[model samples]
Target: MVFEYILKKNGLDPSTDLTIDQSISFGLTAAAFTSSDADYTIEFEPFATTLELEGNGSVVASLGTESGYVPYTAYSARKSYIKQHPEVIQSFTNAIQRGLDYVNSHSSEEIAKTISPQFKETPLDKLTQIVERYKAQDTWKEDTVFEESSFELLERILEEAGQLKETVPYKELVTTEFSTKAVK
Candidate 1:
């Protein structure tokens, strides 16, 4: 969705200007790009860095950078659940803020070393490089607050791609109460 939004933002119609091979499974996109004649591929970390490290492809652009701040990963709960479990929500948000604080406070190499166990197959140096790239791009948000403008932008992206049937008001979909408290 973001990639398509970026394509349209750059004055190209995705349907006519390019072929996006959705047939490739998400996990296999890197491999498919490496093996196939596709000119470009959208990929997430580790895989994207790995591809460049292996000389299979170049890290040409960041869709995250191109699309601006979109909250791609967020903690969500049913309204009923949230109403019933406000404490739980606050605690979870606080934990996420603590994580954000840690990342913001630490050096890329330190953060990479700390997270290396999660990516056992990746070498420490490579992991550090990936972390450096993310840090350079300002990938981590300083706090857990979900900005209304970002929510509106997300809906715009979805609308452009014909993925959003009805736009949900930011107030209806998000609450800054917990994140606000957490950040404080």
Candidate 2:
């Protein structure tokens, strides 16, 4: 949906202008692109960086940058769960905000080193490069609070992709209670 939204925003019709192969699973996009199966693929780091390092493809554009704020990463809980575990949710939100604060305060190199254990196959230099790219794009929000405008942007993107039948009011779908309190 994000890819299609970026395409349409740029004045191209995704349905008619070009072929977007949705058959490739998210995990294999980099492999498919590297294998020359597709001329271009939208990928998240460090796949994009890996492809560029391998000389398979170039990072042409960023969907995140192009699509604007869409609240792509967020936490969700069932209403019942939230009602029962407000304290748990608050703790989780605080932890998330602390992570955000760490990333915002630290350099890309520091972040890459800290997270390198999760991606043992990916070298520190490459991971740093990926983090650098993301930092340059302001990929992380200042806080975990999912803004109303960002939620609306997400809804608009969903609606444009024909996935959403109607827009949900921000208040009905999102609560800033935990995230707002976390930042404070």
Candidate 3:
């Protein structure tokens, strides 16, 4: 979506001017681009960084860094589920907050070493580079508050992609009650 938006802004129609092929995995997409199976692919970090490390491809653009796009990772549940499981959600949020705090306080090399076991296929050095890059980019949030600008960007992207029919107010879509409590 970010690439499509960028292409549109640059006066290129992705639907008409480009043959956009979707791959099931980022690794495969990177491989396709490296092998000339696809002209370009939009990839997010860890995987993208790994590809560059392996000399498969180079990053042409970094939407988050270069384009002012604030891409984020989120955890969500249905409103009904949230209401029924507020305590569970609070516990999970608190745990995540603690984890984030740890990551913020630690070195990238330490973090990479700690998490490397989970990614058995990825080299520790490569993972360290990926973590270091993300750290430098300030990709991890220290707090759980959703920035209004980030939400607006997300809404705009969804609308442009025709995935959203009506605008959902931020309050309706996001609940800061748990995050606030967790932070405290």
Candidate 4:
């Protein structure tokens, strides 16, 4: 859902050097492999992280200030630990602030009517509560931009792992010109 659209929409060159790491089973852990010459990666969920970031070791990328991924459903103990420790858990709050602001500014009926078609499985009333919770507390950061600094961290991670064969030029990997258009 994320990688496919974001990659193609940005005109990333594929085939010659493009590769995705869906191996580790979790997007977070799988992201470690991106340190290689691999063009792109997508490991949505390890189905479980115990099997992902812990065993066989995982290189944690130092994003500096480029932002990071936070699970929207981080009320779980494991998530709480990651959030409380370090990395971009603050990004989680930032994204939630934006989403909550959106939900609060909109009316309940308006929200329901607007999203009903988008989520056919979720009943209107259930969605209403979901929106209410989202308005009440933010748990997702779907709007964060992919910063170059973050990509640089990925490069260093791969290099340290001895996975990088050459270098991935910035222009070849990202295009903020278009992404910024969506930024608020």
What would the per-residue lDDT of candidate 3 be over residues 31-122, giving only the tens digit for each residue?
Answer: 66777767567876667886787787777766776545454577889999998998999999999888888789999999999999998988
Q: Candidate 1 residues 1-184, lDDT tens each?
A: 9999998899999999888889988999999998899999999989999999999999999998999999899788999999999999999999999999999999999999999999999999999999999998989999999999899999999898888999998999899999999999
**Against the correct fold, how does model 3 do in TM-score?**
0.85
Please provide TM-scores, in order, for all candidate models, with all chains considered together. Answer: 0.97, 0.95, 0.85, 0.31
lDDT of 2 at 155: 89
Superposed Cα deviation of residue 96, candidate 2 (Å): 0.2
Which lDDT values do the candidates have, in the order given?
A: 0.93, 0.90, 0.79, 0.47
lDDT of candidate model 3 versus the reference: 0.79
Rank ordering of all candidates by TM-score, starting from the highest? 1, 2, 3, 4
Where does candidate 3 have its weakest 10-residue lDDT segment? 63-72
Greater lDDT among 2 and 3 belongs to 2
Q: What is the C-alpha RMSD of each candidate to the true structure, in Å?
A: 0.9, 1.2, 2.3, 17.1
Give candidate 1 regions above 4 Å deviation. Answer: none
Tens digit of lDDT per residue, candidate 4, span 1-184?
A: 2333233435754333366545554535544643456433333222122223345333232121122332223222254565475345444545555664565578766777787898786667666655554444343334445566656755655554457877798667554432343444
Query: Could you tally the backbone clashes for each prediction?
Result: 0, 0, 0, 4
Which tens-of-lDDT digit does each residue in 1-184 have in candidate 2? 9988888888999889999888889999899877765678888888899889988889988888888887878888999999999999999999999999999999999999999999999999999999999999999998998888899889888898889998888999799999989999
**Candidate 2 TM-score versus the reference:** 0.95
Candidate 4 local accuracy as lDDT?
A: 0.47
